[model samples]
Target: MGRVSPPVLPAACEVLVVGAGPAGSACARTLAAAGHDVLLVDQHVFPRDKVCGDGLIPDAHAALRVLGVHDEVMDRALRAAHVRCVAPRGGHVDVPGTLAVLPRRDLDDIVCRAARAAGARFAAPWRFVAPLLDGERVVGARLRGDGIEHEVRARWVVLATGAAAPPLVAAGVCERRAPSSVALRGYLHHPELAATLRELQIVWHPRLSGGYGWIFPGPGGTFNVGVGLTASHASEEGGRASMREVNLRRMLDTFAAVHAPAAGLLARGELRGDWKGAPLRCSLGGARWSRPGLLVTGEAAGSTYAFTGEGIGKALETGLLTAAALAEGGDDAAVRARHEAALAGLKPRFELYEKAAHVNRLPWLADLVVWRARRSPRILRRMSAVLEERQNPGRLLSWRGMTKLMFE
Candidate 1:
């Protein structure tokens, strides 16, 4: 990982972005392109690993387009994704979509490069220690890098600090709702699964309880496989039972039985190691994302898809929207009003998906849904479209093709 040396901060700038992930980079790129002097800072260096499935849906690509980096990223994408949904009863359904797989390290680097090219100054390995306040208003942030601390001021600040919104919430610039679930994931090498790398497989086992396991392929025959469970269920079951180990074992067992013996593949590829788990926060409920000069976006703003555990896409979308709102040059109240209006239009459908995930309380519901989806091509297509946000029917249960799922 290469680090960019910190540049001397001017007295103040138009915008200051903390935590340069997808959201920060996207916001910086958009704002800078619109001729705003923007400073983007991150705690890590370039090409740093961010634990994610690394799956890019069509909507994500659309977000990249809004940031003007879609073509560049697509040129480096590894594969077009084919989604496979597996049930506890062993039923499965494969639905094709406009999805792609790319490592997060690479993806973030690409986005950061675009932002830099768009004239946003970047400082990596710079920790955002605290927000610099001018009385009751947020003026900028205090950053520490290379063992020295400095104050960088800006007219407006955008917080993209991800899951740990950090001191911002404590500073009263942001707030958080309770997270519904937690996710565990890690990377491994599974050559036998390479051919199927183009296909992103999600296994919904009843034993997992409220969450599913997934296997996503990355560059050079590496795979990311992990499981997620509702926090409440995980707590009730026990804290130290090793969800990652159990899920990895289950995945390897399934893979070996189904595809191991095909042309000496098992000998070539075997279960590599254990999967690591990370916490996942659900950004479903309506919440205020901004305060005064400080605006929040991405995971910090609760923009993740509760059901799919997809946050990068929504994060990017919020980044673009935030940039647009800032570009209009409004006061805090005006920018906040525009931001809330934009989110209001999208929150209902997201809430519906969150509700659907919670509603699958029955042990057999996931299996039944998968079985019916496999039997009906329309169901599979609709489900894929809905999950990818290519189509929004508003009511998840009211879709005629999903009636079997609703009844089950």
Candidate 2:
């Protein structure tokens, strides 16, 4: 239960990974196990809080299994039986799948520890200043910590810096400056709710148009509750402006006002801390995947999905992909090509999720889908498959799918 940053800073390593969340830690673990000299760094101290829904879907389970930490995570996680998807009109469907919840504070620390166990050197509370460039190629980075600046050089640099724009901009790889979406969340402790709420609850309503709210039961009689909005960039100048008039706190209030479960949770549960919000970079198109000597993974590479705003699984996947690409032993061009090709393979699935995000914009569509799912076992299974990443979400979320739903 002890959390402390490493006291020493290394002068160099073969690979330098910034941001010690799931992505960076996964990358470090894989590379370190492969006998690479890896330096993993993060700005925050160990066990720091991250803004997340904290629900681990099936895809997340798969990635954790790949990291050989699935059993450990499950032991620490609050197991969920199904997901209750509530529509705008209050119609709902329960889709069964592999689901669980563990706060990011604990989940991240586990992954970071796995990296350390695999022989990756860990340093934290170190802020990434800028990439150290040799001509057009990145050689390493300049990091400031403890009121001192240090230069850490590496043959390869991996940026797993999540959705923040400043680090991406500093590295000269930021394509869209602003985040694609945003979410606000807080923790609540209610023994009754935790005892009774076995399913993860997700509610969509007209009041939260282009967004949704969730109440995920966690261990220790706590619940993670939040609202998230997918920003509409079609009408904006550069596809970067978030909804100008949207207030997340107001949105949370609106959600509680419209949803009974949220209202009950708020009325009965004791809130743990101030509500915190974070930006999300989704759709996998915001940053360049690779420059000559560097690669970007995780939410920094837009690994979060639009429809669900889930990033942890894909973040771990992308981190592993980056590690595999670099570990294959290649020239710079070969490594870049491998990384780009790997990300390209994941693009179609991300695109399908983006298409499914239409439900976020037209929330009434959720009602329609839920109405049908309530009656159709096939549709219910499809929804479950989408959560498991076994089926294309577009198959059920598209107009073509809706048309079929009507005739069937």
Against the reference, the lDDT scores of all candidates come to 0.70, 0.92
Clashes of 1: 2
The alpha-carbon deviation from the true structure for residue 308 of candidate 2, after best TM-score superposition, in angstroms, is: 0.7
RMSD per prediction, one decimal? 4.6, 1.8
Q: Using lDDT as the measure, which candidate wins?
A: 2
Cα TM-score per model: 0.85, 0.97
Q: Which candidate is the best by TM-score?
A: 2
Q: For candidate 2, write residues 266-326 as lDDT tens digits.
A: 8888999879999899989879998999999999999999999999999999999999999
Tell me how far the alpha carbon of residue 165 in candidate 1 is from the true structure, in angstroms, after superposition: 4.1
| Model 2, TM vs. native | 0.97
Q: List runs of model 2 lying over 4 Å from the truth.
A: 1-6, 232-235, 238-243
Which residue pairs collide in model 2, if any?
A: none
Candidate 1 structure quality by residue, lDDT tens digits, 113-159: 89999999987777878878888788888888878788888999888
Off by over 4 Å in 1: 1-8, 231-276, 284-287, 359-363, 391-408
